[model samples]
Target: MSKITTLPLGFANALLVRDKGAILVDTGINANKKIYEELFRELDFNPRNINLIVVTHGHADHFANANELKEITGAPVLCHKEAVYALQTAGNSAIVPRNELGKSVFEIIKKNLPRSTKKVNPDIIVDSSFDLHPYGVAGKVVYTPGHTDCSLSIILESGDAIVGDMLVPSFFTGEPCVAYFANNEKALFASLQMVLQQASIFYGGHGGPFTKAEVLDLL
Candidate 1:
């Protein structure tokens, strides 16, 4: 069985998947390098034990420290092909709001967030689904494009999905629902439907660990 550990980094989060080897999902911001090191030590995991680093999307908050992590772990960085531009250029993708909250959040992200300085060229560029067996994990990286053109989610064999910004737990009510911002609402819904068919438990970049039933009720 794979163990998933959520490392909350300020406003963002990162996931550490441990099986025969370690797989890190997302890298938080550039300043998170020390946080990663501290967590690795607390978890009793050597940095060298990490075999792969998977960035769920091109967002700075999610992938800003990937380059540093690759250096520390000596692992290949993997991301969707479309994410190359944003990753290499250190630019953010345009966000489309889905509701009033989304609109407010989008404004804050646009106006306040600084562009990440870290630049990374993915070692593995996934076009669709990429199996994780070769990397010693019991899961696969599936393209879940809605939050961004390059958003990807990791679906574990145990039916847990690490969905980055695809869905978020509501701040006020803590209810599971579609994310506030998406690149395309229609595509986001389609991606959510696809995920529902495969995953029983949903983990989000914001707040979650929501059951399939909870998500279904929101939908």
Candidate 2:
């Protein structure tokens, strides 16, 4: 059985999936490394045991520490092919607002968050669905887009999915909602539908482990 653990890094979250080895989904921000290290220790997982680091999107909060984690774990980093440019340029990848909330959030992020320091070159660039069996997980990485043009989701055979910002829990109500910031609303809806067909439990960067029923109601 695969063990899934949610590693909440303050404002964002990362997932640690353990099968025969470990697969880390997202790396949070640069400053969250110590927190991740501590969590790994608590879970009795050695950083060296990590076989792969998957970045769900190119957002600073999601891929900021990917290179660092890869260095520490001696694991290769993987991301959608389209995200490579953003990661290499340390750019925000041109986020387009989908709603009033998205606009407000984007402005706040622009004002507060700094660009990621180091440029990350993905070791494996995926254009379509990629199997994870070689990495010791019974899952695959699927292009899910919408939260960003290169968003990807990790869907496990057990029906749990690590869907970055495509869906998030409301900060105030903790209800499942489409992400506060999305580049394309229509694409986000379609990606959510695609994920819904494959996953029963939805995990998000902001909050979740939401049921399929809860997500359906939110949609």
Candidate 3:
């Protein structure tokens, strides 16, 4: 059985996995490196065992320490092609230009980041949907854009979906707190509905490991 552990990376959580080897779903801010290390210690997992790193999106909080983590574990990073551009380019933000809401969130990340942070690209660039069988896992990548166009979700064979910043659960029904970040409202909604059709358990980038019913209630 594959074990998924949530490592609290402040307001967000980075998922850690234990199967044939370890896998990390995301990397939190570089400034929290020590805390992250400590968290690993508490979990009794050696960081070296993390063989693959999958970044759900390109946000700073979610990818700030990706390069460092990859170096430590010799793990290759995987992300959508859009996110690859964000990571390869040198700029104040990784978000695409012209997205008002995305810009706002990007600014927040820029304002809080350490001055010396750097960007890094993923080893595997996913242009569309891809399978994880080659990586020794029973999962596949679902290109669920609209959160940023770069946003993608992971669907395990067991029906667990790791949706990054796409459809967050809200306090109210049929509405998420924040839907699409990069001005792609239509795609975001479509992606949410698509995910619901597949997975019963929804693992969000911000607020959940929610059940299908709970996610449906919020959608």
Candidate 4:
């Protein structure tokens, strides 16, 4: 059976899927290397068995360890071209960092936390939406901009979505409703509509794995 395992790292997360072999989605900051190694070894996956490593977005917490893992697993890395640019520059020119003025002080504080490492570009760059079937995974890259122009999500054949910081859980604010904002509000809203149409379960960068109904209600 195919499965997705989340590797939470504070405000960020990585995912591991067991389908036709193990595919790791995103690799948290490189400092968490030992934890990842332990997780993979426990799952009986020899490092090289990892077929692919996809960086959902360009945030350091989500991609700091990508290069390290690629060396150990020899897996090709994939992400939207914009995401690649963001990672390669380490938020030096990120649209998200440049557009956080609208968020509350608390949110801005959370967004400014120091990152762990320098950027590393992905091996494969996805400019537009595309199918991952050629790579053996049953999913597609859905361009869901807003949080960042480079922001994207992986929509599994099962309608499960791995969205990076696109939307989060309601409980985060100790409130019944949640909030959504993007570096590009126009693109963010459009992307929200985009996901609303296709996603069944939203697995986000932060607190989530929310049901479509739950996410819709938030919208």
- TM-scores, all candidates, are 0.94, 0.93, 0.81, 0.84
**Model 3 over residues 1-219: C-alpha lDDT tens digits?**
456787766656678767666678877553355676788889888988887788887776677667678766788999888777667652222344234544655567555652226778779988778876666667778888776777878887777888876655442343444453544777877888988898887776666777888766655
What C-alpha lDDT values do all the predictions have? 0.84, 0.83, 0.70, 0.69
lDDT of 2: 0.83
Task: Tell how far residue 13 is off in model 4, in angstroms.
Answer: 0.6
Whichever of 1 and 4 has more TM-score, that candidate is: 1
Q: Per-residue lDDT for 1-219 in model 4, tens only?
A: 356778776656777766666677777553556777887788777778778888777666667767678778888888888776667766522434323233443365565654646667678898779776666678778787777777778888777878877776433452223224456777876887787788687777666678878776766
Candidate 1: the clashing residue pairs are none
Best by TM-score: 1
Screening candidate 2 with a backbone cut-off below 3 angstroms (N, C-alpha, C), the clashing residue pairs are none
Better of 3 and 4 by lDDT: 3
The full ranking of all candidates by lDDT, starting with the best, is 1, 2, 3, 4
Q: What stretches of model 2 exceed 4 Å from their correct place?
A: 30-33
Candidate maximizing lDDT: 1
lDDT of 3 at 32: 51
Answer with 2 or 4, whichever has the higher TM-score.
2
- As a whole number from 0 to 100, the lDDT of residue 144 in candidate 1 is 92
